[model samples]
Structure formats: C-alpha cells, structure tokens
Target: MKVIQSFIVLVFGLTVLVTNAQNKIKIEYKPEHPLKEKIEGQSSLNFDFIIENQSKDSLKLTRLEVSLFDKQNKLIQQKFLDNNGTAPSINTIPNIQWNSVSTNLLFNPFPDVNSMTDKLEYTFTFNDSIEIKKVVIPGDYEQATDFILPLKNKILVYDGHDFYSHHRRFDYEFTPIKQLGFTGNFMRYAYDFVVLNPEGKRYLNNGKNDTDWFGFGTDVLAVADGEITAIEMNQKDDKTFDIPSLKDKPLALYGNYIVIKHGENIYSMYGHLKNQSAAGLKVGDKVKKGQKIALIGASGSSFFPHLHFEVRNSINHQAEGLPSYFKNYNLILGSAKKEGTTHTITTGDIIQSK
Candidate 1:
C-alpha cells in the first residue's frame, strides 16, 4: 500500500550561524519528502530552523530572513516560526555551539524554506539546486514510562493473548461526522483493534430504547506517568463528534488531565472523560501505575463515550506520534499468508496487564 501522500518532517536540533567574513547566516531545517503541502495548526511537527555565524571574526549581523511554501509552489504562512520563533538549547557541554549550521558558502543566495522537494526544477536564481536531507536520531522509547488502563483488561485483552490486535492506525474513509482530514483527530490510533463491545453502537440503534449505548465513549487513562502541560477540552457543536476542532478555543475544564514527563521527550494524552474525573489530577499531582487518573464518559468533543490515547516525543509539543508496543502482549496475524514482517495476532489471547 502507498504509505505517504506527502511528508514534511520538521526534525528538531539543527545548528545555524552567520559568518562575519561574507556576512551570511547559517541555516538548518527538518527534512521532509517535499510533496506535503499542508501546515496543520497546533500540529506536533517540531520545526527547528537555526541561524549562526562561523567566521574567523565575530559577526554582528543585524538582519535575518525566512519563508515557507507548499508543494503547489504556493507560499505557506507559518505563524509560529518568527524571527525570534525559538530559543537557544541548554548546553550541558562547556564548549558552547550554535544549534544551526549552514554547509553552503557565505553570501550564497538563501533558500525560500517554503519550497517543496518536488517543485525544485531549478534554483530559480542560482546555478545551485536545493536539496533537503534527513538525519538519524535515537528515540526515547528506551526511557522508562507508565500507563493507566481505563477499562482494565477488557479493551486491550488480546494484546496479551492474541496477535491480531497488533494493528496500529486504521485506514479510514472520511465521514460527514468527521471533524478533521483523516476524519476525527482525537485518538482513532489508540483504539485500533482494541476490542470495543458493540453494545454502545447497538444501544444507539435499538428502536426507542432509553438505554445509553455502552462504547460510544469511555474514560482515557494514562499509559504512563507524566504531569499536565497542555490541555484543549472545549469543542464545537458543528464539528463532528469525537473530533475536537482543529483551532484553539477556551479550555472547557472537563474534569482534569495530568501530563507526566515519563522520560526524556515522551508524553501521553488521555481525553474525552467525565467532568469530575480530573478531581485528583491537579497540575503537579503525582500518580502511580494502575492509579485512577480519570473516569470514562462522553464529555468533551465526543459522539459516544470512549477514550483517546497516544504517545510521542513532546519536548517541543508537536503532533508526531511514536509507534509503541506494550510489555507482555501477544499477536494474532490476520492472514493465511503470514510471512516476513507479517504481524500475527489472535482474537482470544489474554493480554496481561503491566
């Protein structure tokens, strides 16, 4: 299956400086495939572009410039990456080094930063062409963390017992009720293959039944320890259920939420809970494994009652998601054609709790 329509991976941690000799600024930007044309608002893509000076003499350059664009060669507006958009990284090393580095010689014409990888037929002004590169970086999954299951062993049962539940993101067609592009932007990935008792949807279908559906929504618990950093609870009436509006709004104050800094650069999100569920989850409040963080219900931005879950490197607070594997879980491969890299999972496997 074709995996990418386009990708603009804004990998952080590049060094930039300006040289006094030629009076040029050093630059670095995250590498992406270049076909991607959209800039998601409040997305988790941490863009780290830097400028620095690397000359035999110190440079007192007073001016800097930057621009962004999409694959259509259309200029893109990045409201966040301003001239002072970012700050210097804390240097534990005694020798200080700027975070941005430019390999191109000084006074070389600067890149538009907005141009996509596919659109570079020529460097419009220079004989040189533009090319973006990717660098390998270690992930923080190696860091210790914690998780709190809401329904306990019910939803994630097969995780320990079967392999079929190894599924991750589900391919979905847009529904009228969907709020974002891929439909709902909440936590569809977290619920992938985690068995949901159709009782919730069933109750909604029963003719004139007063019974509330069971799985429309539920309480989302922490998959690990962390303190609350940011929370967006308010939702719009027009947007599809379960999908919070892409734009920012007033905090609805649904119960509470805790963002524990499990390890370096890792954070988890649990949303759509009851009003009072966040009672014990104060900003600095500490919780343990299996400790109740919140209750399940259809509270904010939801159609049915269920939980939304995800894990990612939150150092810069971007939308990038990390693929996670729980300890002591089994898989049920959903094919007779199981072979190389085929994920095997079953329906009845009991995924033991951590």
Candidate 2:
C-alpha cells in the first residue's frame, strides 16, 4: 500500500498501522566536521530538527512548534512546520572527507539521505529570535607529538563526544564496560582518538553545573612538571553553572577557572575548577608535574563538571596550539605499536611508560 493512505487514520487520533510495524524509527545524527569547535563558534540561536517517520506512513507534520530558549529563562524562539512533505525537511547532504590536515566538502544532488549512505545536507533557520552564529575566541592548543608520552593512570578512550562512550585509551578501563566499548552518540571526531575519562564517569556536559559532564577532569591533565603560573579565582558565579535553561537547575554556571604553565612553549588549562582555584593559590608557587594542581569543580562557563585542558606556546596571555608529544612513552594502538617519544602525538594509541 502507498504510505500516504495511513495518514488519514493519524488525524482521527488513531495510531496509524505503520507499514513497517516492527521497524522502529531509524534516525541518525551526523554532525559536521570539527564538531565541538564548530558548534562552539556557531552558538547562535537556531532550531534544527531531523525527524523521520520510519513507519512508512509518509508522515505529514505541521505546526512544528519547537520551543527555544536563551541562557536566560526568556522564551527565545519557536518554529512550525509550514508545509507537508513526504520526506523530512532536510535541505541537502554533502560529501564530507576528513583527515589529519584538511576537510573537503562536495555537495550532493539531493538534500537529505539516510546517514549510512548519503552525502550532502540542507540547513534550516529559525525565527527572528536568532542571530548570526557567535564566534567565541577559539581555545588554545600547543603542537601535538608524534612520540608517546607515557602516563601512569589507566585510560578510557572516548571515540565520540557523548554520554558513557569512553573506550580504552591505554589498554583497559577496569570495568566490564571497557570491553563493551561505547554505546552513545558520537557527534564529532567519531574516528578520532581522544583520551577517555579517568574517573569512569562523564565530567563534561552542557549544563551550567560543574559536574554535568560525561568526561570531567579525567584526561585533561598536566603535560609536564610545572608551577602554578597564574590563577584566575572568583566565586561570584557569572551565570548558573548548573542549569540547562530557566526551568532546569537555574543557579550554576562558569563556577571557577585556572591556568598553568609547563615550560617555555608548553602550558595547560584547567577551567571550571569550582572554588578550587580561589583557595589561596598564588603565582610562582612550585608545583610538581603530577601533583593535583586543582580539584575538579564546576566553575565557569561550563555546561557540566569537567576540566578543559590544552597545550599552548605563549604566556603573553595567549598561545596557539602547536603539535606536541610526550617523553618516554609507547602506544599500543588496538593491539599494534605506534611508538614515539619527545616528538608530537596525535590523539590515539594506548600510551604507557617503560
């Protein structure tokens, strides 16, 4: 039977007998490349939906009102379906190719196709409550290494950026889930190798709290032996560090922050440290490499509790991320050896010291 006939029953408040009665809605989200960086930069207000009527009913959705909000509790915007189409309202899909260096985009003919097979995508805009995508200053980074920097802590490699998706970074995670790998959404860098959560829980999230994350303070650790370089301590929470919108935990946001220097060209950042950075920290204090510089706390501009660590090259207040590596380490990448030391390390390979 043609799928459109099923919709007649849907209007009468009757559950239409879907064509694939047993086939659940199969919808997948494929975030564009540079997922975190792009979303962080384009954090303007907008409404984006990718709904599929997988039941073979040729769904007709109208009056699509999507409630939108701002950092504040004010209702920011709303969206409604204007017309009826057999397919979801995606505009286009494009051929996306990624590598260590650059990304290339090739626009496909059709706008939308199932993620498993399609290229090209269409975008949608929201009501006037939106503006141009904001551009927060990019975070800092130092050059990564081609060598292996051995670490003592057990590692969990999060293949994607979502909930409970930590994989094994350095051999094992000490739990049954370690062997199971990840089972959550990976919006960006799906194939990229990232250090997993050390604490066995997510320390990072999009709530204004210090602990709403899926990978907090676990992997963003000290890169070298260094001292407390500079500490930006404050307890006056700028915004709710613990909420999603006005309705959720509405009283926590950007709780605390700190920065440390490792060497001439290497530095590290520990942001959203709760009140930790404020507790009698002084400049020029001597700190060992592995010593706990600051406790994990949700402090500033955080949607969750996690540490945001990065390596950079300057102390003039700003440094760009350069390629870098650790000393005396070998990586066992998925049962293979990608060995290096004192050079630069890309985000993969199980690492350890001899």
Candidate 3:
C-alpha cells in the first residue's frame, strides 16, 4: 500500500463586504477535491454548497447562478435559481445563520477532470441596495488511497456514498457540535455494510434482536496498516433499532469506534461497534491491514446492526473526508457481477473480496 501525503484542501467562497455595517457573505463547499463519479454510467460531479451570513443583519439572495467551466473556459454545466418558481424558496439568511444546497453536474462529454472549475454568482438585496457578487471556485481531484474491505465476508453496501445517501447529504450546520470543535461531513464517502440472508433481506426472522442480523458481532478489520490513535469501546450498543438522541454528544455518532492513522493526516475510522469488542485494544497500538479491531453492532445513532467505515484526512471528527478505492473486489447487483481492481464502490453493491 502507498502512503498518501497530507494534501486535503478546504475551499471557501470569497467574503464580500457590503455597505451595511459589519455585513458580509461566506460560502463553503465539501469534498474539496471534486472527483468525477460515474452516475448511471454518465460522468457526474456532486457537491454541497453553503451560504452564510456573518453579520447581525439579514441577507436576502434574490438571484443565484452556478456555472462550471473546463480548462479552456468552456461552459460545461450551469444552474439557475430565483425567488419565484423554485419550490420552498428560502433565500433569506437570518443574521449569523446559513443556508445549504446540494447539486450534481452530469455531462455526456465530460470535461477535462484535471482543470474543471465552478463559479457561483449571486444577487443580494440588503440595506436598501442590490449587490451582485461572483466567486470563481477552483479545485482538482484528490488522490484516492488504496484500501481493502474492512469486513471479511461477502457483504452488502446497504448505504454508501451516493448522491442521496445520508452520508453525502448531511450538512453539519448545528452550532452546538460546531462550537464543540466538530464540523464538516467527515463521512462524505463513508460506507454502511450489512450481510443479507438467502431471501435477499438484511436479517432473519422477526429482525428485532441484534442477534438476528447476519452482520452483528462480525469482526471488523483494519482497512490498512496503521497505528491505532483513538478507541471508544465503552458506549453501550443499542438493544433495538430506535435512533438515540445524539444531541450535543458528537462522539456518540460513532459509538464504540476506532481510529487508525495510516499516514500524514490520513486516517481510517470504523464506527458503531459492539461494546467491549475492542476491550484489549488501546491507543498507540499497531494494527495490520487485516487485523480484527472490533465487532459490528447497532450502536449510537444506528438503527440496526451494520458497520460504518470511512477514510478521512484527520483522526478527529472535524476533518475532511478522503475518497477510498478498493483492490480485488466483486461488485454484484442482481445477476450481474463486475470484478474490480482499484475501483470505486457505490450504494446497493453486494461486495465480495476477490
């Protein structure tokens, strides 16, 4: 395995100061390195957009337009928004508050991925004046680290990083968690895995007990060779599928999880494990690529037994997510199975290590 040097970049919109006293606008985006993902066989780019009001005054965005350009500055994609026609219009950003939107760009003749760029233009009316601002968003793809399946069985990717997956759609705008030094969609490319029975369902009869799920208690392995930097094995596993209140408890989202540092600022997190499963493990412990580190369980915010896995830039929860590519795996969907080497896996994939 190759060690990826720390190169995570955070992109923010240009701050434009208005005539109003202490009024400014801020824009933020995730998956800082926008990679071209193959959606439905067409090359696509997905992103999350956020607009923040950094002052004590309200800001009403009257018009908004987003455009994508290639290396040659040729327009490849564009999005338009207005106060009317667009459903659920909420262009007004309250003082010190923020608004977010998620968009995807699909192109038949995909632009050169190396130098593609995005531009955001907005018209705002504030302090009795109409101001127009345009910010050029520039970024490139981040190098993906080669990883292996964390679980040792033919598993189902119940929910992986897709356009609509909670992992990709979650916007960490909560002030409490942000104030606690935790922010960012660290699980942007995360995976939730479960094992299916012969009937193509997640569990067997009744499905009430964690024991009924095939994935429960299964050993979770290290995705790569690294030193364990953090461990949380005390959080009790949920007995049922009811979602727990994770308010103000940032760490609870990953109950009984483990963090392993693979390289400079490169870490892999395995979350929602059975309590005490990693009882003998502690920080600073060295683990191999296939070493068993914990057991899959319904813990924290999880509604059922599953393994939540992700590769991130930092060991902490406030870091940016890094894309993951697996080696020697078979992605099976229905009767069609595709063998992959160094390939990106998506939702609904029945994966088996080759």
Error of 3 at 322 (Å): 1.6
CA shift of 174, model 1, Å: 14
For model 3, how does the per-residue alpha-carbon lDDT over 1-354 read when each residue is reduced to its tens digit? Answer: 123322222111122234432235555455455556433334344555455565555555554545666666677766554456655233332231223222121111122222335433333333334354544454434444557899878798889877667787665655554555656777877899897765567888888888989889998988888999888887777732222334344445777789999998788989889999995999999998888998998777788899998877875556777667777778766777777646457888888777
Which residue pairs of candidate 3 clash? none
lDDT value, candidate 3, whole model: 0.65
lDDT of 2 by residue, 123-200 (tens): 222221111121111122223322223124433332322222221111111233223342211111111222344444
- Candidate 2 lDDT trough over 10 residues, lowest sum: 128-137
RMSD for each model, in Å, please? Answer: 18.2, 17.8, 11.9
**For candidate 1, what's the RMSD?**
18.2
Using TM-score as the measure, the top candidate is 3
Q: Is candidate 1 or candidate 3 better by TM-score?
A: 3
Off by over 4 Å in 1: 1-143, 146-150, 156-211, 215-220, 230-258, 315-317, 328-354
For candidate 2, the per-residue lDDT at 22 reads 19
What TM-score fits each model?
0.40, 0.35, 0.73
Candidate with more favorable, higher lDDT: 2 or 3: 3
* Tens digit of per-residue lDDT, candidate 1, span 144-235: 44233434534433222111222222211223322233321222123322334422122445523222444433445566555666543333
